[model samples]
Target: MKTKKPTQSAKQAAVRYLSRRDHAEQELQQKLLARGFEQEEVDEAVALCQDYNWLDDARFAERLLNNGIAKGWGLLRIRQEMAHKGIHEEVVSHLFEDDEFDWFEHAREIAQRKYGDSPMDTDKEKARRLRFMQSKGFDFEQVKYALDVDDDEY
Candidate 1:
C-alpha cells in the first residue's frame, strides 16, 4: 500500500472539510490540524482555497451574522458569537452599527412570545422573567419596555 503524497493528502483533506459546510480560513486550518495534517500541508491547502475565493473571513462573519439575525438573536449575543468564531472587531462593529440589529425589538418580541399579556401575577414570576430576559442579553430598559411592567411592580 502506497502512502498518499502530501499535496494530494492536503487537497483531499480540504475537500473533505469543505464538504461538511462553509468554513473560514482559520476554521478550516484548525480542522485540518486537528485531523493530523502537517503544518505546511494545512497552510498550502488554506492558501489554495483562499486563492480560489473559497475561504473568506469577512464573508463568513456576514453569513454568521445573517443566520443569527434570522434566528432572532440579539446584538450582544451575536457579537459574542462572532468574537468566539475569531471574527475581527471591526467587522463585528460594522454589523452592530446597523439598526436592524436592535436588541430592544428582539427582547420585546421574545418577551411577548414567552409570556403574553402579562400573565404573571406575583413579583417572583416577574423577577424570574426579568432575570431570564437579562440572561438572554437584554438590557434593563429593553426588558422593562418588553415586559411592560410598571415601576410599581418592582
Candidate 2:
C-alpha cells in the first residue's frame, strides 16, 4: 500500500481552493499555509500549479479589474483591493493603462443614481455629495465633475 504523499495532498488542497476563484501566488501560498500545510508542501503545490498554468497573477488581476468595473468600483478602490490580494503594482498599472473607460462619466452616473439629476444647490449639499463620491473611491477631479457638472454640460 502506498502512503499519501505530502506534495500530492498540497496540490489537491490548492486545486480545491482555486476551484472557487482565481488567486494570486502569494495569496494562495498564504491560504495553504494558514490551512496547516507545511511551507515546503505549499511551495511544491504552488510550483506545480504555476507549471500547469493554473496559477497566474496577470490573469487574476485582469479578471479582478473587470469584475470591479462591473460592480461600479473606481480605479483607486480596485487598485487597493488588488494590492491586498498580492498583485503587483506593475500589473495593476499595465491593466489600467490599457483601459479606455471614462471614469468621470462612470462617477457621474453613480452620483446621479444615488443623489438625483438635480445639481447640488447648497454648499452643505455639495460637500455631502463630494464626501459620498470620495467614499466610493473617486479621485477629486472625478468627484468634482460628477457633483458640479450639469447634465447639459456633457
Candidate 3:
C-alpha cells in the first residue's frame, strides 16, 4: 500500500488556521512561518485567506476593538493591543477616530466604580491611581478626567 503525502496547499492550511481562530493576515502568515512553512507558502496562505475574506485586518480590528472596549479598556490600550495583533495603521486610525468621547465615558465609569464618588485627597493615593490608570492603557488626560482630578494635582 502506498501512503499519500499531505496535499499541503495554502488554502488547506488557511482553512485549518481559520478553523482554530480568527486571525489577521499578517498574524496568520507569522504563525505559518513559525510552523515551518516557507515565506512563499506563508504568503500564498495569507492570500488565500484574504481571497476568501476569512482573514481581514479591518474586521479583526473592529472585533478586537469591540471586545476590548466592552472589557473596559481605554483607547490607548485598545490601540496598542490592535497594533500588537498586526492591524494596519489605517485600520487602527479608523477605529479610534471620533471615539474619544466614548472612550472617556467608559474610563470614567470604570474609575468611578473602582474608586467612588469622592476623589482621593492624599497626593500619594492619587498618584497611585494615576499610575494604575496608565498601566491599564489610559492616556494622562483620560485618567485625569476619569478620576476627576486636575493634571497638576494628580
Best by lDDT: 2
State the lDDT of candidate 1 residue by residue for 1-154, as single tens digits: 4433445487678977777777877778877777677889899988888788777777888888788767656566767778877777887677566646566777899888788886787889989999988776677888888888777777
Report the candidate with higher TM-score, 1 versus 2: 2
What local lDDT score does residue 47 receive in model 1, on the 0 to 100 scale? Answer: 88
* Candidate 1 Cα errors over 4 Å, as ranges: 1-8, 150-154
List where candidate 3 sits over 4 angstroms from the true fold: 1-9, 98-101
Model 2 Cα lDDT, one tens digit per residue, 93-123 = 8888878989999998888789887767776
lDDT of 3 by residue, 44-149 (tens): 7787778889888988888888888777788788888888988889888886676645667787888887788676878888888888888778888888888887
Please, what's the RMSD in Å of model 2? 5.4
Count clashing pairs, candidate 3.
0
Quote the positional error of residue 13 for candidate 1 in Å: 2.0
At residue 130, candidate 1 shows an lDDT of 91
Candidate-wise lDDT, in order: 0.77, 0.84, 0.79
- How badly does each model clash, as a count of residue pairs? 0, 0, 0
Candidate 1 accuracy as lDDT: 0.77
Indicate which candidate wins on TM-score: 3
